[model samples]
Target chain A: MINKATEVFVSRGYDGTSMDTVARELGITKSAIYHHVKSKEELLHLAINRGISALDSAVEDERQRTGLTALERLRAAVHASVVILIEYHHSVTLLLRVRGNSDVEREALEQRRKIDDKIRALVAEAIGEGGLRSDFTPGLITRLLFGMVNSITEWYRPSYPVDPEAIADAVTSMAFNGLEA
Target chain B: MINKATEVFVSRGYDGTSMDTVARELGITKSAIYHHVKSKEELLHLAINRGISALDSAVEDERQRTGLTALERLRAAVHASVVILIEYHHSVTLLLRVRGNSDVEREALEQRRKIDDKIRALVAEAIGEGGLRSDFTPGLITRLLFGMVNSITEWYRPSYPVDPEAIADAVTSMAFNGLEA
Candidate 1:
């Protein structure tokens, strides 16, 4: 049910979507939807929570937890983020497009900020360890880095034969080596 | 009038914004707004057109025109895009967030896609000229590159003491040299 709601949210957008629409999409009565989810806000909370939890898990994965250099951990985190975003594309898309119009959305936005701060700290750590450049502010670098990864939510489609590994490799390569020949 | 409308649209979102709200924000009568723009869609068109025209001019700037390699043109385009997006942050933000639910929005989206394709072509040309790495697909690289640049619209604020030149230089350097030490 959450998946169906996510699909509706992703396609119709959060503000435009209503419980009635979700029910219609699911071919069920609105009462049935209410039985499972109390309101559209609750459904949005569930959907965004799913996306946030996946991202949090990715950041805390073993690759980032183990004895790795800050740069290595950052790389692992980036790759994991891309994979999770692609794997949960609809929910992530909905999460990214959120505008924080309601209390539930504002809470989701706070959670997103927490994730962003965690990544920013990792960038600062890598720079401090002499594994990444310190010339640019870590905050700026973090925005640009995750900006590229978060873009996967905007363009990646399941119908396209895109290889997740290829995408992860390309992102890490472009981010680390850059595009210069 | 379009500026005020853009502000309302940016704050309340396109769907949630109404002519009544725009007029209220502008301290004008709704009929006064209708005198300039027949409908909310027309106001949206004007606001988005302003942003699109600015972007088009930036892409066609002299720096991208004379005695520049494909890579140089690409760099110039990226810098110009960032600068314009920052300068017109509100309207550009509205343009980026448009979900294409209306005819005017769909038209704006088409124009956006045209701009995106032009940028993608430049990326391909740069790669062909051996100015950038050819290992990654040009399309993917283009998306990531613009993804980083476009993120400026999300966070940049007029009150922030951000120097556009510094931002452009940092973006170019980071895109070229990357984060690795």
Candidate 2:
């Protein structure tokens, strides 16, 4: 149901989507949707949280990968982030469009900032370990890194021959090694 | 007038923004707005085109930059592109949010695709010159590159000490040399 809502929200702007639309799309009565969710905002909260929780779990997983160095963890986390973006593509799309107009969106934006801080911390650690470049601030690097990673959601189509792992590899490679020969 | 419209459009989603809102925000009457523009979509067309024209000029400028290698031209173009994003920040923000819901929006999106094609062609030519790594396709590289560049609108504040030049340098540096130590 959340996935269906996300699809509706992504296809139609979030402001343009309604509980009635979701209900009709689901072939259920409006009361049936109201039984599970009081408002469209509730459905948005649930759908957005689906993507947020996946990203949170990825960050937590990277944080606890005991054997890996900061740089390794950062790379793995970028890969994981890309995979999660693909898996939760529509939700992430909706998340990116959020401008904090509502309390729910504001809360989601705060959670997103927390995740960014975590990624930036790992980037700082990698620089401290003398693996990643020290010249660029971790904030800038993390922003650009995820800028590239987050872009995957914009252009990727499921029918394409490129798998998530392949795209992830391309992202990590170009991100670390760059385009220069 | 376009600037004020862009400001309103950026703060309020295009679907939510009306000529009355722009007129109100600009301290003008609805008749005054209609005197200059027929509808809200016309304002969107003007605002979005401001960004598209700036980017088009940047690409055209790079294309004419003589006595430079393909790699150098690509780098310079990235710098100019970043600068335009800052100069036309609100318009670019609105442009990024466009999902081709209207005829004007679809036209804007098509123009945006042409710009992307221009940049991707430069990436390909750079690779052909043996300066860029050929492992990744130009389409992938160009998308990631603009993804990093386009992200500026999300967090950039003019109050920050970081100027557009500094941001552009950081972008091109990480883009070309990457973050590896």
Candidate 3:
């Protein structure tokens, strides 16, 4: 049901979507939806949480927690983020489009910031150990790295032949080695 | 007036904004706004075009046009894009958030795609001249590069101490040299 709600929210703007629309799309009564979810806001919260939990788990994955080094863990996190984003494309798309008009959205934004802080910490650790460049601030590096990865949500289509692993590889290569020949 | 509208759109969202709100914010009569723009859609068009024109001018700047290798031009475009995005942060924020729900929005999206294609061509040319890595497709590279650059619209604030030149330098360095120590 939350998946269905996510699809509606992704296709229709969050403000434009309603419980009635979700119910109509699901071929269920509004009362049925209300029985499970109290409001459209609740549904949106659940939908966004799907993407957030995926990202949080990716950063806290066993590999990231016990990696070869900070750089390795950072790379793993980046790769995992791209993969998870692709895996939960619809929900993440909805999450990314959020503009914090409501308390639920504010909470989601806060959660996203926590994830960003974790990635930034990994970047700082990598720079500390001389695994990554230290000239740019870790905060800037984190934003750019995630910016590149997060862009997948804007243009990626399931119809495309590209897969998550391929994207992860490209992001890792371009971010670490750059485009210089 | 378009700038004011852009500000309102950036804060309240395009759909949530109305000419009445813009007029209220600007301390102008609705008739005065109607004298210039036919409707809210027209205002949105003008606002988005402001950002689009800046980007187009950056790509067509004399520096981008003459006496540079493909790599140099690509770097120049990257730098100019970041600068322009910061310079026109509000309008570009609205432009980036547009989902093409209206005719004006569709036109804006089409213009954005034209700029994207131009950048992609630069990436291809750079690869042809051995200035960039060819392992990743030009399309992928362009998306990632702009994704990183375009993200400025989401977080950049004029109150922040960061300057456009510094951002441009960081983007060029990280994009060309990458993060490897």
Q: What lDDT would each prediction earn against the true structure?
A: 0.84, 0.88, 0.87
Which wins on DockQ, candidate 2 or candidate 3? 3
Q: Regarding TM-score, does 2 or 3 come out ahead?
A: 3
Give per-residue CA lDDT, model 3, range B35-117, as digits (tens).
99788888899999899899888986723577788888988888988989999999888889888889999998898998888
The residue-by-residue lDDT of candidate 1 on B3-27, one tens digit each, is 8788888988777777788888999
For this target, which candidate reaches the highest DockQ against the unseen true structure? Answer: 3
lDDT of 2 by residue, A1-181 (tens): 7898898898877887777788898888999888998788888999899998999999889877998889999988888898899989999988987889899999999999999989999999999999898877898788888887787777877886778788888788878877799
Per-residue lDDT tens digits of candidate 3, residues A54-137? 989988882357638998998888888999999899999988887788999999989998999899988999999999988889
Off by over 4 Å in 1: A62-64, B62-64
In candidate 1, position A38 carries an lDDT of 78
lDDT of 1 by residue, A64-121 (tens): 5868898999988998898888888888888887777899888888988988888888
- DockQ scores for all the models shown? 0.73, 0.73, 0.79
Model 1: residue A174 alpha-carbon error in angstroms? 1.5
- How good is chain A of candidate 1, measured by TM-score? 0.95
After best superposition, candidate 1 residue B56: deviation in angstroms?
Answer: 0.7
What tens-digit string does per-residue lDDT give for candidate 2 at B35-63?
Answer: 99888889899999999899999988997
> In order, how many clashes per candidate?
0, 0, 0
